[model samples]
Target chain A: MERTYVITGAASGIGKATKELLEARGARVIGADIAGSDVNVDLTTLQGRQTLVSEVERLSDGRIDAVLAVAGLSSPTVATAAVNYFGAVATLEGLRPLLAKSDSPRAVAVTSMASLMPHDDALLDAFLDGNEEAALARAAELAAGSPEQGNLIYGSSKQALSRWVRRQAPTADWAGANIPVNAVAPGVVLTPMTASLTGTEEARTQLAGMVPMPLNGFFGPESVAQLLAWLSSEENGHLCGQVIFIDGGSDAVIRGDSTW
Target chain B: MERTYVITGAASGIGKATKELLEARGARVIGADIAGSDVNVDLTTLQGRQTLVSEVERLSDGRIDAVLAVAGLSSPTVATAAVNYFGAVATLEGLRPLLAKSDSPRAVAVTSMASLMPHDDALLDAFLDGNEEAALARAAELAAGSPEQGNLIYGSSKQALSRWVRRQAPTADWAGANIPVNAVAPGVVLTPMTASLTGTEEARTQLAGMVPMPLNGFFGPESVAQLLAWLSSEENGHLCGQVIFIDGGSDAVIRGDSTW
Candidate 1:
């Protein structure tokens, strides 16, 4: 039987890469995105999330084998936290019932190496505390302040999303239901989302300084897609709530053994 | 001249212990708390935080040497995130200018072993995103759900707070002003806060299971206070933005070279 999967941000970047790879591998892929996808739904609002969940349930007939929340934003903006943290979470939680109907359900979310960067305490607090409206408003306010502030929102959103995956993995809705939930923290990947940075020599140099990729140079979307596919596969049963960093050793270089 | 220091939550627990130790070392200590203190201030509200900051500035005549954000909440409550993350941050950030007046200014906050526990993504995001109202409301909602939920809030608040300190340490207001900022993450300290857990055999066993303190049994408040004092003293110059886990090998046991 072909595995049925729902992938968000499926119109571009790593999400699109994953969708292509999964489809080529004989999986039935339902691609959701803001535009130019099978399902057109904005992930930044509660209504948008509800629309996505209902659409997935209808498309899959109330059964889903895997869910890949790959849609995300890199630049700082008011919508960054809403999209990265809440958007990803809504996909998983809202589709959880459908995943439960499957014999082997698996889920994965996209975090980023940015999670290791400095974060604003207030932003983190609002998201964790479940105040989406306030969090979004604050994120927008920060975005208006400066690009650096936006970067902070981006990093904190990824960090919080990864933490959420870890926390929820042990709960009844996930690991308890035999649905292994995990996240992938990737380094700089050559995608449309990062074209602005990779295209500019100075920006690339500055990025390299901030995150020294001890492995090869920057990664292709396919490199990260491969890892995401495996984690979301039925073969992956034991691993739960892990944020596997496929960042070409960026996390290793920055954090070192301090967190170990 | 003896250095003057302001310590919040000084009426009890780690704050009280830190105050006693600092005073014994011939430093002038200003204790702040809800009651029976040199300064009566609640750290859970913005107004409370503002009052504490203004009082300290007035008392020090705007020439204080150090600030210790030791006031914190362990149990799960809506106030946990507010007091633990925002309150501590407000203390340090609000009083930053005054500390700059000293020849060698230092600041230390009390985080906990709880930081290692599973945390809610929403709560962590809200706090880190700087959305205080939403974060507090979400925390209260979670507290209404269960104690375990409360535990998650407590742990995440500490984790976010520590991250905040790390993020701000390298900035102009701190290291640039010659003030070192750091946090102490202690494990299983024998304080009034842990009386219920340490007092019960079952709770002790459960705690041991969650965090194996291989180095020693439960520690006294003074043990943690000693570390805080050193971190806050002029003797500490080069170290900044470190959440040193003085947890008797709990962090070592749990994370174990993975983050190294």
Candidate 2:
């Protein structure tokens, strides 16, 4: 029997590409997305994520091999966090039980290139403490007042989640559990999001200029999709809690110069 | 005239040690902390940080050389971000004007060993964005009325800040502004914070076992203070945004592990 995989956000873009790639390669795939026919679960809510896990469990018939969580929103900041940050967390938490049944389960989630921003101490501590209620309160407070703060809140939420992956990685006992986890960070990708940025000339110019290495312009969805597929494969067992940057060598161009 | 310097969190621990070390070398040290009189300001609040900047400006008397933000908190996570994270940003922003006035001004901040935690693309982007208000909001949302997320917030915050520093260091234009910035990550020190950790049997056992190398237990404050002083000197111009780890070879030991 071929190994099976489950991918979220399979309705479009990278997620769709992943589904086609895996299925074409003979791996059984259970595509989960808000728009998919078989698994139309809105993963932004806990219940929706739980349902996704249940569907994957049933599809795998007691042997879901891996989960590739590409489900996310690509809006300004708040929308991004609602789906990408908390949504990913809910999906992971809900899927843990089913994944545990696999002989060599792995997971890879999607995050953005924008999370490179800076934050001071108080804000960082609140996120790291992982206090659910307080984090929500803080987010609401910041959102109640301004857009700039809300944007930072979105990025910081992702930042906290990333660090949580790293800190917990050392103690995960993944080897014993036969599970591995990792993340991927992609730079500018020409998706519907990129089209939206072009709505304003300033936004388009600024976004385009941010990339140091000209990959003829920017990466497309297919570029990121390939990387995600590999990360979700059994061939990637050794890597865990790492956010590999696939920015067409843009990050490398700043050798000795780039801070991150 | 003796070269003048400012040290916050100077009442005890690393701050106090740095102050004494600098003063011993004939440097004029202006100590500050909520617990002391030279300057009393809470770094967590914008207003408090402004007061710190104002008082430091007054005390400089047109002879300020460098600012060392060693002030930090040791609470589980939230408090750590409040002091170590926000305090650092507030102080730095507040001191920029004064630093620009100096002939060859430089600044250094302290981070923790816990910053090695992993991060995702979204979080990394958020951190690199550097919008403080947004950071606070996202932090609030993540904490979500709970306190647990705050425990791990420090590592996340530091990672984001460190990444930002790295990003900023390459082209900060601080030299043109007559100021430079740098940071250091230290391991457990023989301070009140470490002492408290020692008080807890579980923490002590866990930390003791976690020390990767044959460490000489916790490092003395002077060891780190010396590093801070050197980094702050006008001589270290090219070292901006560099986060040097001073853990008595623990980081190196981990690097050599066969696990990787």
Candidate 3:
């Protein structure tokens, strides 16, 4: 049977690649992003999240097989936390009822390998605690306090989002409903969001030092697109609450063997 | 060709189940344990690790296909750290050369869902630092100190071992050499090691409260064995430095999502 999927951040980057891959495989894809997609709405607000939920529900006729919460931000600011953590979580939770209608429902989000980097505890705690207000406040404080703290916003937001995945995947609404929710933490890809990191020779060398992708170095979105396709595919069973890293070997090089 | 595997702790529990599962599938398995296996050798000591490596090398003509470092202990003592961390690392590292000779080489070990539990930092640090003596001493101290600290022994040891897999898989010796190293973190397997936790209703209830395996609740060894087999099998190509959890949703229940 043909499957239908709702993919956020589908305008470009990994999301676009995965959307195209799924479409090529004869699946229906409803793209959602800030602009130039089926559902164009900012994900950093309650209204936008509600709009996405209602629109996706209408387009898919209230039966969505999978939801790829691929919308994310690399900015070192509070907005990153809003869109990455709260935005992603809202999209998943909202579309979950639609997902539960499918025989093989799966939810996967995009988290960055930057999640392995050092982050702010206070901001991370707020995110895990599910306090959007406090988390945003703390993110702003960190952004305004120190440059290093500002740099930590992206990592902390993604880490908190990952933790949310682990926390909610097994709950009654998800696992009890037979929905498999997971995440894919990719290393630096040559996405426009990461242009600064890979555009210059000096930037590439510095990135190599941090992520150390020994397998194939920095890769394109197509490499990660396949992994996401597999995770959402019906063939994947028994892998619950995992954040599979689709990096060349960034997780390995960074000593991310199994730190939980 | 019938793939050959060297599985430690093959006399009982998940290891034995995995050994049997592979053999039933027409795969050749060389079981290793303290007693009652093809190669009887203790895995808690450096000498034992070396002995097992040499015997497997000789038995398999120094061209072993895969090594499953399944030998582990749940005891809140220094030996748990010694066997679970140092011994396991030595076994994989020692057997890497033999594995490299195979057409498709793989390495996997047993971590636990307990890796998500709170643990001793100094002990974990010592293990990651690769200082066997210091790690053991710290483990001993924790074991002798508060009972709370003692409880962290097993978790800390397993966490360190997971870290080691992540740390080495991306390096020149593992992924760079065309070999994939990973781990499986199971939760509350009904093995002899966990008899105390699953033997009675009261114990089972307590265990559930702690680990919370909501999906099919307290699964048997065979469930995890298949996952280990896949990790060591030739089919797994892109997954490196991962500690895939086969714990029936315990990882998700414990909020252990995407943690580095």
Q: What is the alpha-carbon interface RMSD for each candidate?
A: 14.7, 13.9, 3.1
Worst 10 residues of 1 chain B by lDDT: B251-260
Off by over 4 Å in 1: B1-260
Give the local distance difference test score of model 3. 0.85
Q: In model 2 chain B, where is the ten-residue run with the lowest total lDDT?
A: B251-260
Candidate number with greatest TM-score = 3
Q: Residue A155 error for model 2, in Å?
A: 1.7
Against the true structure, candidate 1 reaches a TM-score of 0.53
- Most accurate candidate by DockQ: 3
Candidate 3 lDDT by residue in tens digits, A15-101: 999999999999999999999999998999999999999999999999999999999988778889999999999999999999989
Each candidate's chain A: what TM-score?
0.98, 0.85, 0.97
**Residue A29 of model 2, lDDT score:** 84
| Candidate 3 structure, TM-score to reference | 0.74
User: Model 2: runs farther than 4 Å from truth?
Assistant: A76-79, A119-126, A199-202, A211-216, A249-260, B1-260
Assess every candidate by TM-score: 0.53, 0.49, 0.74
Cα deviation at A201, candidate 2, in Å, is: 5.3
